[model samples]
Target: MNKCIFFFLSLYLLCFQSFAQTSSVKTVPNADLVYEKTKLGEQVNSPYYEGQPVVSADGKFLFVYRVGHPDNVGYKTYKKDEDIWVGERMADGSFSTMRNVGAPLNTATNNAVLGISGDGNTLFLYDQYNLSADYAVTNIAVSERTTDGWGKPQSIKIKGFRWVSEPAYMNMSVDKRILLISYANNRVTFGKQDLYVSFLEADGTFSEPLNLGKDINTAGIEASPFLAADNVTLYFSTDGRAGYGNLDVFVTKRLDDTWQKWSEPLNLGAKVNTPFWDCEFSMTAKGDVAYFTSGGQNYGENADVYQVKIKEVARPEPVAMIYGKVLNKNTNEPIATKISYTNIKTHQNAGLASSNPKDGTYKIYLPKDKAYSFFAEKDGFFAIKENIDLTGLKTYTEIERNIYLVPIETGVAIELSHLYFMQSQPTLLPSSEDELEQLFDILQKYPTMQIEIAGHTDGVGNKQKNQMLSVQRANAVKDYLVKKGITAERIKTVGYGGSRPIASNEKEETRKLNRRVEFKVLSK
Candidate 1:
């Protein structure tokens, strides 16, 4: 048995156990589980140069940047501007022939794909779009995947971010909350290129870059940082750590919420590392297979992208996949919208995804052992948050949950999806924060809107006491909104004790559905 040391099982998720307890964990790499590496061959690797490998979150797309290759934008036989190439993963585990990603992405200047969003709807590009025909300063840019190829790349603003000559690499977190970058920011950089982190701000811009500190960065160079789906496990290449090569790939676990502390860096061993240069490790949600670049693997002193199967212990922390469609409740039709999720206990922005415009489907990967509140939003739709508990999850899973958004209008009684109360009391539980905050937001957006709060209980409860308890719970919610500055006159409350059971009351599973809080628009 794997001697898993989950330090804070005694702590509750409500307390945010990951950071609330010990700042230590053990995820030993199983040497037997690592397979031999295979080069990508002529399609990706060429005589000129091939390096800086990046794989999409879904593992469907693999992109690499090349230098001096004839297939480049300028087709330079000598040293020239870089160009990005893309390949799709075939069913048989082979990648298709690399095709030059032309136009806006590949110019007379260097270009690369640093990261891709979890939903595969967004791409994190190498540099800004507005530039002279000559090479310009490099900075990260973003582009959305549209029906018409990709949308125009937009350069994002990062406070105090500047670059001149040194190379840089970055990876956007799976939830898009954090950006892990390897760059030489002279201000905080301990030495040459050091690993740093930037947080996603409320306005969609990135905060000022903060060096990941001495534990992970050194006076040497750190390149190609890849933040795994778990957000805690980080894989990067560095000459700072003792390894098999000049620059070897290493895995490190983040000790706490602070981007500073880290576990001792572990080299990937000779199986994945060599006496030359080995780096750029990327994987999908499953974390079973890895795609990286190994220099001089096929051609002498030339870099090539390679793939290998890694065992569970060496992979990133396991995560579960949630996928489904956002549909209309009344008409049962597909709806194209943005889906958002939040951590109920911590009340933090967890992740984001987009439903396909044509099919209304969305996919998101989340870490196990936590609770989440997720939903889709539209102007006329009430963005009710549905809950999911992965606290007991033990393996990778694909959970399909179709969200149905109900129209917001007069007399539309929409039950609060994830709202809950303390056992038999009227106190609102912490998990109710997401739904209530959403309700508050909708009310604020539409200033003149009025709503009624109704509470219900299962039929097994005492009639009079149940009615009193239900009313108290409804009042509790009303008080919450009122304290938040909403006018009391615009809100009303009622309780239906065991009268409107939505499901069978005999079993606790279905009976819980009957005990719920709902809201109806009194006026709009």
Candidate 2:
């Protein structure tokens, strides 16, 4: 009985230890599984092909299509009665209750459902028409949701570039003002069926159209664009870009306002592509779910809709932290301080909890790819300024530094790689005086800046004697700065003894590093 109890206890302890080692992770849903159309409503007409379904903001209604051709341009034998369909998902999970919307919204034209905004206030539809060459010409139209019903459709126009063919298959920006349009068989030299964007002005007119440029548009055909709700990411289809086969859905993202620095286009991969054409891509508002048409085995008939999950490219988590303790130069103890960070790009401010009173350590979370202006201020201590430039950092980093507040001193200790001090000694010696002259030049430039002359000794000999020797060494430096024409009023002297060392006194090199004077900036 005793052996069994011990065995179970050991097993429980091992399990608990394993659980403690693993951190909880947030789960993200697959982007493609959000929407799929399986069957037609019983009340709806025969043999319905209900794909390109966009859900309303409340997730109740789905706006889709029933037929592909209305003008009978390509399908000459099929009926030319293309209609936009609407189905509301009842509370009990059945969509047999589908209804056709009223006039001025769905016409006899080839009106294909594009997308709906999250607020349910705007609906985008693509109207396909026949051109002079018997090819299809597609234009985009938007309808505003009025109190009673949708307003009359307004044709979208983009300036500059003329050949805007397929607007219905494009995605809109977050504000629903900017639209991404695709052109097919147009004489665009860069890529076939390239995508373009046009911004809607305040007067309901669109601005000049601009090509999606090199990162997104490839040499081959690229169409069927979808913008995530964030408005910075774009997902589209292209056969020219790197993919598993024929045409594949790809995604790119905008960094800041610059579209040129977009992420490389990612192929939706084998699950979303097939041997034949797999283009026309659409996604949910959150961007986790993507749906496209494929002539694969899962589809019962020709070119059925298939869904696949997509993940946004993972960005490196920012983990670089600057942690340091501010200490009083005289007492060698921590001090409470206030800190602020100025963003270098936007000149914005960020910080947390000021500086903790219990400990002088301030931990600032630094971004992986941006510079920051770090400022720390306390009532008596002079303000501290540090320009942290992280323009090209890739991985997580950590740094520890100790800030010494110079007592009102004429000379301050500045950390320099070449400066060296003898163990438990405060003498300037023969080697370091040349570097100290550079300090004299710095003090002359900042005339108003006061400083505290600090002296330190390695963890050796009597602590009290080391402290006294450090004071004498600091006085010696003050005399030098004053002789160099620095104002005597700006000078203060403080001796830290062996109590405060920049590095551990374990090695001879560290001991040499510890025994030194730092010309700390007092005020400027």
Candidate 3:
């Protein structure tokens, strides 16, 4: 009898030890980490439950799921239906009052925002059922931003699949070509819930969904998947793996282009994950800051959105973030304009954004190892052109530049900073296309306006040869614009040669400024 009791006690102790090890949060790898975690406060978070937060690329707007709010458009009863809410970030960095996203999106049922496109023009939402009110049916819908407001939501149906049950969350790549989804009751789902991916096919239909396999999914709940802008790192919440709580956030990296292989999942550690539910993880474009839902003392009885400075050890791939306001140079008033950026090396578009019509703020993300040409343009104002060089940069960076657009006038002249030419020849480089297109757009907008294309050279070569080359360059621009359907009579060409110097021609930087192409309005 004594031996039997001792053996049972030993067994009990071993089981307890295993449970303790598995349920305790792991310490972060680094010892000296600098980070500050703060709750978003009452302006954005209410007494009701809130989760599933997604920030816009510009960081000016936040979309989230709010539950049990009486004012919610879809509120049938307290916590039965969830609705999407939007909160605008103020100039002081605090959030304004939360507002319901409204209309066809919220129809007295459960509708939640899953993700938003990088341009802030498309919104992804998951509806609990199709329009016909079919049982156990789910649909992933998208609403595009029109000139007036959000248009009607359209459901995305998979080819040959039926009854897509409970689409819990979804995310898309920066280009919107690949979609990452977390749904339940599919044929290939490994568990009660799993993560899947679909590609946007050339036919404008989404391909069949493919499960994300055993490496990322298990026979347990896996939901709230978020793919970072870098397109390689993925974050999701799971309960099948060893974690401190019933659900915890985990991150994995795509091993290759195949997307089938991935690195082993790693827990985000105690700093970000806690003993309670900590999920719905998302990061800013630069991945420097993260927002998530946490249930703690700060949040009375439900989950609330919280933010923390992302430490170096847990960040995604390095990227450079450009964010600021676009204002009128004369009156300092905010101006609504379209912002476009392109990679100069690869000749691919980096991304695009629009300044907020009310505040004129904008933000965009640029990947490393390429030079970029950024342009800001609006009607009745001269376009602003600037260059950003990120080649060989090894770390993440944030640039805050306030762009000032000059109003167009007869005497105002604007330099075409992105126009490039071969060493000594008048042939236009392919890199000059983006800038030339901007000039073409300006002419198209103001049809009655006429301008002179002027080319200048630095005082380095022979005077007569320089003057002749300048003339060739000016005529080259005029010919290109004319070929693009612009009236040749509207554009006149001139060669200033070295006569007009905007800056001293002593140093290489100054000389480069002198060797330029510009346009001055001749008439309006």
> Could you tell me which 10 consecutive residues in candidate 2 have the lowest summed lDDT?
22-31
Write candidate 2's Cα lDDT for 1-524 as tens digits.
Answer: 99999999999997765455322211123313432323233533334454455555334566655554332232345564456667665777544445667466766455566777543556777644332354444346677665467778766654554544433356664335567777753554476677777776656566766766787777787777776544566777676754544566666777755455677776544445555666566654444345566653222123554445444333223335566776776777887655555555565553322334556655555555677656555543443345577778655466675555534443444543334445445555544444465567667767788878787777878888988988887887888789889888998888888898888888987787777766777787
Give the winner by TM-score: 1 or 2: 1
**Residue 113, model 2, lDDT:** 67
Best by the lDDT measure:
1
- Score residue 388 of candidate 1 by CA lDDT: 88
TM-score of 2: 0.46
How well is each residue in 68-94 modelled by candidate 3, as lDDT tens digits? 888776565545567888899899887
Candidate 1's residue-wise lDDT over 428-463, tens digit each?
987677778878888898899999999998888579
* Cα RMSDs, all models: 11.2, 20.9, 5.9
lDDT ranking from best candidate downward: 1, 3, 2
Which pairs of residues clash in candidate 1, taking residues 3 or more apart in a chain or in different chains?
none
Each prediction's TM-score versus the true structure: 0.87, 0.46, 0.73
Pairwise lDDT winner, candidates 1 and 3: 1
Give lDDT: candidate 2, residue 352.
24
Task: Give Cα-based local distance difference scores for all models.
Answer: 0.79, 0.59, 0.76
